[model samples]
Target chain A: MSGTVGLVLVSHSPDLAAGLRELLRQVAGDAVAVTVAGGDDDGGLGTSYELIRDAIAEAGSGAGVIVLPDLGSSVLTAKALLEDHPNPQVRLVDAPFVEGAVAAAVIAATGADLDTVADAAEEAWHARKL
Target chain B: MPESSELTVVLPAHLHARPAGQIVVTAARFTSTVEIVYGAKVANARGVLALLALGATAGETVTVRATGDDAPAAAEAVATALRTTS
Candidate 1:
């Protein structure tokens, strides 16, 4: 089994995803296996899923993709993709939009698995006291 | 001539560049020295890395105190800025 955890960022606006990507790059450095799949500005329900699906597939097998969304559509979009994709090993982490994004990228780039990264993200959320 | 005001405002998220940037910008608007007190450490409003090092998360209030001619307004500005999203 491959040990790389692929990451996908899905946000309502591309700016959020782009901002997250920039932050991740600054924190994670250049050696991480992360990809960004930001939604387009057209604003459609199912559009984001396709981008997410494409990103995951492109990342290849044994690569767990973590999706970070801005709001609203991301929850549904991630759910639909996960249900249709049907990868038991592939984790669909519902991390906090901003905090989780940074945490997930930081964890993933450091060579942790998707599950571990997701756990870290969850821990960060609880720490937020939200 | 100025009244000093100090209060704790829990950061709603981890201290990062965006939030730090907002804080620095707000602090620049005032003449008071804004200090964020976490534990025994105190960080200047202008240092982003220092603020992030606090690792302050939501619900964990950090004490903010200002001493200047406009201390009350300064403290209030900091509080309001923290309430706004970056």
Candidate 2:
């Protein structure tokens, strides 16, 4: 939690979130705080508001938190949490899940500010897989 | 300003997400404007998306160009990052 910008990955699948965490650890190292908020309370394929909220709080180290969601409900859950909590340091990025996570993780690990990390996450939207 | 260097990517996995992310991080450290030229494609070194778009594979040669006060260091650092296997 001492890093510049922490990350919360929201997904419908726990394995996807865990795999992405491992991938981010390999790319960005251990400097940034990466928390996973995937699946529902029952460990099913759904987004959990409590999980997202808890992850944002856990990952935040005073600098900021960037949340990346995989799909529809995940995004809605994260946005809903933001609306209810209204934390200025939190950002919900509309970006590709894996790519955005990697990009943001690398930038955040460098001790970048919240806006910079958010920008890096958004930039992943233009990533060309072809 | 305007320093350039050619580097061969030696990573067995090529310029995948991890290495491309590393390159972006390394290039972002300098104040220089860095770019990676692979064949006909030119990618912004500071952007992970652009770097990944280059599709630079292992053993492929790419040119690193930079223009700023830290151009030299930027070019060298980017080159080193590309040349690194891990």
Candidate with best TM-score: 2
Model 2 lDDT per residue over A10-111, tens place: 999988999999999988888889999989988998999999988998998889899999998999989988998897889999888988998898888777
- Candidate 1 versus the native: TM-score? 0.56
Weakest 10 consecutive residues of candidate 1 chain A by summed lDDT: A121-130
**Candidate 2 error regions (>4 Å):** B1-13
Candidate 1, chain A: TM-score?
A: 0.81
lDDT of 1 by residue, B1-86 (tens): 76677988877766665565456556766888888887887877644445566776676778888888988888889878776634
For model 2, what is the alpha-carbon lDDT of residue B22?
82
The Cα error of candidate 1 at residue A54, in Å, is 0.8
- In angstroms, how far off is B4's CA in candidate 1? 43
lDDT of 1 at A96: 75
lDDT of 2: 0.85
- For model 2, how does the per-residue alpha-carbon lDDT over B1-86 read when each residue is reduced to its tens digit? 34554444444557877787788788888888888888899998777767778888877777888878888888889888887745
Stretches of candidate 1 off by over 4 Å are A1-3, A41-47, A61-63, B1-86
